[model samples]
Target: MQTNEIDVRVREILRLALKTDVPEEGSYAREDDPNWDSLKHVEMIFMLEDEFDVQFAEDDFAKMGSVAAIVALVEANHAA
Candidate 1:
């Protein structure tokens, strides 16, 4: 999928999982965003996996802190 498409889908997943409309550009990290708590983080992972039809490795979970990182991970896994 194209980067823009990935971005749009990622944003939607974030909005659903985080239960808020995500900013166009800002920190989505659990450290910085109160909406990204532990439970929501896991939910976000599941949503992204289901949305992209790709399973993420355990190691990749830590890198899912921002939309850019999530998009990159999906792109990489989709390519593989």
Candidate 2:
């Protein structure tokens, strides 16, 4: 709907699935972020769908990197 709404939902998803509330924009990378791993990434993707009622394709899932990227994905697919 709105940017703030999207950000809030994304932050909630990260907090719950990744176990962290810190996303400093260009400061997080998949290989370096503490909460980022293969298994947790999958969990976060599933939770994003469940929590936000959005469906992500498998390829879309791979394209997601940082928390910012996930937020962008959710916003991009929000209406679909």
**Model-by-model lDDT, in order?**
0.89, 0.75
Kindly report which residue pairs in candidate 1 clash with one another.
Answer: none
What would the TM-scores of all predictions be?
0.90, 0.77
Angstrom error of the Cα, residue 74, model 2: value is: 1.4
Q: Please give, for residues 1-80, the per-residue lDDT of candidate 2 as tens digits.
A: 78667666776676677787555343454766677788888998898889778899889988888666777888888756
- Determine which window of 10 residues in candidate 1 has minimal summed lDDT: 24-33
Best by TM-score: 1
For residues 13-74, what per-residue lDDT tens digits would candidate 1 score against the true structure?
99999998787665455666787887999999999999999999999999999898999999
Q: How far is candidate 1 from the true structure (C-alpha RMSD, Å)?
A: 1.4
Off by over 4 Å in 2: 23-32
Off by over 4 Å in 1: 25-27
